[model samples]
Target: MSKAKKKKKVTPNQQTSSSKWIFWVIGIIAVCILGLIVLSNMSKGGGDERAALTYDNQPYLGKESAPVEVVEFGDYKCPACKNFTESFFPLIQKDYVDTGKVKFYFMNYAFINNDSSRAAEFAETVYKELGNDTFWKFHELLYKKQNAADEKKDVLTESYLEDTLKEVSSDADAKKVASAFKDGKGKDAFDQDMKTANDLGITGTPTIYVGGKKFEGKTIDDFDQMVKDAAKENK
Candidate 1:
């Protein structure tokens, strides 16, 4: 008769170690999942308490009475902001602002550098002196100029800004704007925008809000749909 076959048995210590290893792996996975959920919620603006945000006295594009309001917190020196302006803003302006379906405001976040803040102040000065139409024109021109410069160079000096203002509007008073820049005419408005951005927990460039809801997508269709949804909800 053949000898009885013998089975190798796992020891109690080995079993306990295996169980602990499995639990450790599972615990790590659970922590990772929790982190992802929290980040996703923060990105969607779900974590912050929504404040009564307003655009009164701010430089804006589109009709004041438009049903939907779109606000962008942007940095002038941000390449992503420039990309959005060149690639996506045309569609937004054509489909939403021009059609009066959405009111859009560009607020300065000024995170890149001091020059970023200065550039915003310059735009504010233009808005205060030259009116909405000229301010929008200057706004476009600023991004265009920023896009054309070398990546390592800083080209947004006072002289260059004054020249851009003149190019955007023949009626722009270069001397008055220069004096205003010297006197820091736009500091209060820029500071107010910064305060609002901080209060809303905005920490990045091109953070867009559609009808007071954060827009997380980056496509034309996404933006168009958000505007439409906001309009529909209000109606």
Candidate 2:
């Protein structure tokens, strides 16, 4: 019979060396995984850097002392803004603003047309002249008129603004508001809001912020949860 070849037996030291190599490989992988996790957390934290929450002479709705502040950078002529205002705003108003949990502010980011600037100027005029109560009324009216203008494909003219003001409030100085539109009385305030929008890096309407965090949510439930989270953080 042919002699069988002798198998090389692993000595204790060899077995230990093999075990050490395996452990070294596992240690490298574990360290790599830990590094990845730390980097991921750092990236996420960097992306959520707190944004500016207030601006000089900004118009707001809700309790001034509320724990959370929700800011909306929006264009009056943007349909998405109108939809948000008409749909989500009421729910937010009831749950957060009305409940003294949040303070809401609207800042102009007019980009669509001169009509956008015009509408923003008019809204600012109403806010400046009529105070918060009437400002909210005019706010809703402007969006309604904007929707109307969309369907009619008509320019939001000086006459349209005047008529809308009259419809908004019997006490509204329609002539004065119109004259402000003509003379550009609210131009400074409008420009200031625009600057705020630019500084905030807002490129679209309905960009919302809660507690200096950009709200990336699209539903009412998301909004509710965001508010709750902000409230918790403040506490």
Candidate 3:
């Protein structure tokens, strides 16, 4: 009294077709993985997809025709930036910047605090009003003053920056620098720097680049070696 149900059998051709489809899918997936690996390798190998070195009105040191270029994205209020300025940057300056093998440029990435932005604005004003040589001097002086003060205290006040300007450059007009700082003559330039830093995915201060590639080295010798390699490539 029990009824038995019969099952339908799949054809060999149908099974082969399904297997081919699965193989095609697996092949496509493998190709995609290989493509991703190649793109990642290209990105790691100094591809142009990363941050570009733009010299738009930024202050720099060394010869304009220098074969290699070094760019630093820094925040004035960052303690690490202070340390780099005091300890590592001088060696870079002496070895590469002063020697004219590299052109060093500074860009503002003022994200630490409001005073960081203020100090960056003041620096932009100096670069606009006082010129490159004075800007470099004030750049050093600002780091010196930052290291001399309490780290937690906001020390880069307008008056303090003005005094620092006077201390660095005797011929600089204090009132003009003050008014420029207030009226935001340097704001656009500073904003450009900020935008560049954001585009570069920079999350910290003192991010440096050599020959338009992000410098991943942790030590001074590593940086010097990078610069030397870049110089050789340029030649």
Number of clashing residue pairs, candidate 2: 0
In the range 59-141, model 1's lDDT, one tens digit per residue, is 88888779998998998888889988898888888988988899899898988766788789998888887788888888888
Tens digit of lDDT per residue, candidate 2, span 1-83? 99999999999999999999999999999999999999999866764577755555677888888998898888778888989
State TM-scores per candidate.
0.75, 0.75, 0.83
Stretches of model 3 off by over 4 angstroms after superposition: 1-18, 31-50, 147-153
lDDT of 2 at 96: 88
The per-model lDDT (C-alpha) reads: 0.84, 0.82, 0.85
Count of steric clashes across candidates, in order: 0, 0, 0
Stretches of candidate 1 off by over 4 Å are 1-51, 147-153
Q: 89, model 1: CA deviation in Å?
A: 0.8
**Between prediction 1 and prediction 2, which has the larger lDDT?**
1
Clashes of 3: 0
Clashing pairs in 1: none
Determine the C-alpha RMSD for candidate 2 after optimal superposition of all C-alphas: 5.4
